[model samples]
Target: MLKNKLATLLIYLVAVLITVTFICILADIIIHGFSQISWGYLTESPSDAGRAGGIAPIIVSTALIVFLAIIIAAPLGLATAILLTEFAQQKTIFAGFVERCLDVLASVPSIVFGLFGNAFFSLYLGLGFSILSGGLTLACMVLPILIRTAVEGLRATPDDYRFSAAALGITRTTALVHLLLPTAMPAIVAGLILGIGRAMAETAALIFTSGYVDRMPDSVFDSGRSLSIHIYDLSMNVAGGDSKAHAAALVLIVMLLIINAISMGLAKHWQKNRIISNEIII
Candidate 1:
């Protein structure tokens, strides 16, 4: 009992520390950033080498980059996760090999992905430094994370679910499509959300694959700059652009937080409905 209480106290203390840190960081950014966020700043395109005007193009480009990345990554990640959890033998050499591959993949530095994107997608495939190239690069980067989280989610489903399906004479394929997939939706979505966060904030990978164009993208072939890259350009390269960078950082943080909240809410809502529907059907 004494050990249990001590462990509980330690967990609470760690939680408090993390909460306080986040609050402090948010307060600092918002204080410096809120004043810079005007309607014109958000709606007008930047001018005078990023020293004047707004970030309208930047916002649009960032949205497209994130959208493409998600579309490219989610399907591949889900397929891999399903294959590993539902098909592969748990104790087999093949399973062990794949797990090791994921471990190494997750540990690879992001900058290396940028180089690979530049060499392969940008040059070899002739996609050049375009939104499509960037999206594909980010897809590769997000795969490892999604695979890890999705595997956990799939494994979390109770064995009884499979037993019940078997008892009902449901085909394995049908059960997977109708029951297991829906039941695992929340976990899969949670992984996708994390992937979104990583892809959205990624700079190095986009640096090589997504060009530093300040204008809004007209097509998938067009090059674009993301918010994170915009922040880097203003803060590091441009003179007298700190205020705008701060404003962009503030927007990025708020956007991420909002996306996270909405994704989580949707996942939970769908998961609940799926559970209800499955219960009725069974």
Candidate 2:
């Protein structure tokens, strides 16, 4: 009992410390940077090498990249996860090998993905530095994370659920689509949120694949800038760019928070609906 009490106290302390730190960071960024945000600041294009203009173009580019990446990755990731959890035996050598590969892929440094993006997507593929290339790179980065989370989520579903479905004479594919996917909705949503967050803040990989052009792209093949790259360029290279850097940081943080809030809300709603449906089924 004494040891359990100590462990509980330690967990609480750690949680509080983390909560305080995150709050402090968000507060500091908003307090210092909110003043920089205005109608003109948000609507105007960046000028004078990104030191004097607004971030309208950057916002558009970021949106396009994120949209493209999600569109490319979500279906593929979900399908792969379904295959892993539904078809492959958990104890099998192939399944274990794939999981190990996923773990290693997830642990790879972002900078390495950047270089690979540069070498393959940007150069070999002849896409050059463009939104398409960047989005593809981000899709690659997000794939492992989403697959791992989704596989775990699917695995976490009670086997009784499958057993009951099997007994009902439902096909395996039908059961997967109707029951298992809904049951794993919350975890799948969480993985998507994490993947989006990672894609949003990534600078290095995008910088190599997506050219840092602070303008609206005519097409996916056209070069464009992202918010993360904008922040990096402003803070590291441009003179008198501190305010803009802070403002961009604030915007990025706010975007992530909003995405997380919406995704979590959807997850809760999905779980509630699932519970109601199951209760009705019984």
Candidate 3:
């Protein structure tokens, strides 16, 4: 009984410490961020000296990159997950190898992805330093995460559903489309949110592939910088003190929070619906 109590106490202590650390970080960000946030500051664009301009362009560019990256990553990631979970049998050696390879790919660093993007998309593929190239690179960077999450979501669905659909003489494609995908919606949505967040926070990869253009992205072929890259440029290379960088960081944090909140709400709604459906079936 004493040992069990000690172990429980240790777990609670660790949990509290982690919570405290996270709260401290959040407090720091909020304190610093609120100081730099103002109507005039957020609305205007930066001037040549990184002063007098609002962060409008940076916000716009980041949105463009994230939106385009999600558009590209979602279908590919979802399809890959569906294929792996629904079609690929675990008994096959090739399936096992592919799954292991995906796990390895997920562990790769973001900078390496940036380097690969710079070489293949920018130079070899001749896409040049454009938003499309950058988005593609980010898509690849987040693909493994999205795919794995989606696979887990798909796999988490009860096996009985698949068996029932199959027993009803449903085609494999039809069963996946109508049954499995709907059941895995929450997981897929969660993965998409994560992918979007990753795309938003990426800096090194975007720096090399996207270039440091500060204008609005008129097309996918146009060059632009994400919020992360913008913050890096302002903090590192700009002549001013770190004021603009701090403001940009604050904005990025706020945007990420909003996205996360929305994603969480949606996931909860989906989960609730799933529970209701399951109860009804029972």
* Position 39, candidate 3: lDDT: 95
lDDT (10s digit) by residue, model 3, range 1-282: 999999999999999999999999887867876887899877777787565577777777777778878898899888878878887866477768877888888888888988999999999999999988898898888889899899999989989988998899999889888988887888888988989998898998888898898876788788987889878888788877377777778788888999899898998898788789879989
Query: What pairs collide in candidate 1?
Result: none
For residues 137-170, could you state the per-residue lDDT of candidate 2 as single tens digits? 9998999988988998999999998999999999
Stretches of model 2 off by over 4 angstroms after superposition: 1-22
Sort by lDDT, top down from the best: 2, 1, 3
Candidate 3 stretches with Cα past 4 Å from truth are 1-21
- Candidate 3 positional error at 279, Å: 2.2
Clashing pairs in 2: none
Error of 1 at 89 (Å): 3.3
Q: Which ten residues in a row have the lowest lDDT in candidate 2?
A: 89-98
Off by over 4 Å in 1: 1-22, 263-282
In candidate 1 the C-alpha lDDT for residue 45 amounts to 98
Model 1, TM vs. native: 0.87
The alpha-carbon lDDT assigned to residue 141 of candidate 3 equals 83
Per-candidate total of colliding backbone pairs: 0, 0, 3
Q: What is the lDDT of residue 201 in candidate 3?
A: 89
